[model samples]
Target: MAKVFFTSDHHFGHKLIIDFESRPFADVAQMNESMIASWNTVVAPEDKVFHLGDFSFLNKEDTSSIVARLNGYKTLILGNHDRGRSRNWWLETGFHEVSEYPIIYKDFFFLSHEPMYMNKHMPYVNVHGHIHGQKYEGKNHFNICVEHWDYRPLSFEQIRDSVVVSEEG
Candidate 1:
């Protein structure tokens, strides 16, 4: 059976992301290779991955190659930087689907490129990225940013358990 995973803010090919986000890697190539290796370790060819946003800062050639190297069927939740790029551009980069706004999954989890408000009354759990290393305040909100998850994609079970733990604590 295929599994579901979530991750974001890879910022591939962006050297500045290392300094801007305090990423441990020494350079962009290291960061890009590391993330790809880490992602493949957990994600299988049959699995599906939801990449929240900021997928890469690569040029068309780099973007195409990078996406092809990754494991799983990938879906992109368009980030701010993802704007100005055409739908075909994203599709050509190997995204199985590209969404323009937050989407409700299983009618329970809300997926977005940016952090969103979520509470018991809101009706859906918010799973998002784009805040990098910053913490969020909402109860049902979970950040799947690469900065938060050791640069690897998180399984659905991992995300759900996090929320359960947060609620209990």
Candidate 2:
């Protein structure tokens, strides 16, 4: 079986993304290229990757090109920024599926953006991205943004090791 990977909020080609958050790249193009490079390095052609949201900063044309350069079979969960683009734009880019809600896979639940209401009701692990990973520490939630770019799909085991379950129970 192929390995699975999850990541989100690349915001490729968006220069201001770095301004709002401290990231390693100085510009959007560089950020975009680096993410593509990193993804190719970690993900193989047979691997499945889940890109939660905000895949690109450019128009659909540019986004499609970048998607072609990356590795793996991609599934998208639409984010707030993805609304302006047409569904056809995403469909043609090699994405297997696209939606604004959650998807269940094995022992985990995937959301493109975070869901504020699913906390207590979810039985499996919840994997999501919108907030950079570094922003929260020791919490059950995992953020993919570490050292600047989002880390590609990690299993529930990988995430659980870094997360601390709440003591309220």
Candidate 3:
């Protein structure tokens, strides 16, 4: 069986992306290259990767090229910014599929972008991207953006270890 990995919100080629939440990157192209390199370094050809949303900047051609370069079979969760030309680009790139909401994998909830309000009422853990890790401060529950990881198709066990979850009220 292939390993599975989950990540989100790369925003490649968007120079101002890092500035929005105070992420540190010199420029847009630099940021895009870094993300691609990092993802390739960690991902394997046969692995399955889940990209939550906002995978690239506005250019469809640029986005398609970047997607073609990345490793593994990708499934996309459509973010708010993912529409129009970007959507067409994703289709051309051979992504497994793209959806507006979460997909359940082994009981865990996977969303491309984080829900504005995560209802604690849900039984499974919500794994998503959109909000950078730094914004959360010390709070648990949200995992920050991961451009790449060595393991393909990471499991709930892998993700749970990295995230800090608060006790339910």
Candidate 4:
């Protein structure tokens, strides 16, 4: 059976991200290669992957090439940086689906490119990216940024298990 996965903020083909995010990769090529390998290592072609955002910073040609090499049926939730292209343009670039705003998943998880304002009083758990290594203080928020997950997409089970919801605020 196909499994579901979530990830964000690859910033592929963006050289300056290494310096800005203090990524260990020596260059953009290395970063891209490493991330692609990591992604394929765990995800099968039949698996479903929701990419929260910042999938790539390359031109359509280059982005399409990279996306073609990746495993899984990929969905993208647009990030602030991803606004450079239209939703249809992203579809043409290889994402199976694209969304300009956050969406609810499993009646509980809120998926988005950037962290949403979630609280203990709310019934939702926000699974998001964009803040990179930083994470919110409560179980109501989950950060799936590549920077926080060893450069690979995490499975939904992984996120669910790690996020221990408490009964009390």
| TM-score of each model, in listed order | 0.96, 0.81, 0.78, 0.95
Q: Candidates 1 and 2: which is better by lDDT?
A: 1
Q: What are the candidates' C-alpha RMSDs? A: 1.1, 3.2, 3.9, 1.7
By TM-score rank, best first, the candidates go 1, 4, 2, 3
Candidate 1 structure quality by residue, lDDT tens digits, 1-169: 9999999889899899899999999888889999999999999999999998888888889999999999999999899878778778899888999998888887768999888866568977789888899978877788888988889999988888888897899
- lDDT for 92 in candidate 1 is 89
Query: Poorest 10 consecutive residues of model 3 by lDDT?
Result: 147-156
State the lDDT of candidate 4 residue by residue for 1-169, as single tens digits.
9999999999999999998899999999999999999999989999999999998999999999999999999999999999888999899999999999998989878999988888668888899999997867777889999999889999988887777534242
Instruction: Tell me, by TM-score, which candidate is best.
Output: 1
Best by lDDT: 4
Please tell me which model should have the higher lDDT, number 1 or number 3.
1
- lDDT for 84 (candidate 1): 70
Least accurate 10 contiguous residues by lDDT in model 2: 160-169
Q: Per-residue alpha-carbon lDDT of model 2 for 1-169, expressed as tens digits?
A: 6777777888777787777777778777777777788888878899888887777768767878998888888888876777677666787776777876677767555444663344545565456667763454333345654333453456444555544344233
Error of 3 at 150 (Å): 12
Compared with the true structure, model 2 gives a TM-score of 0.81
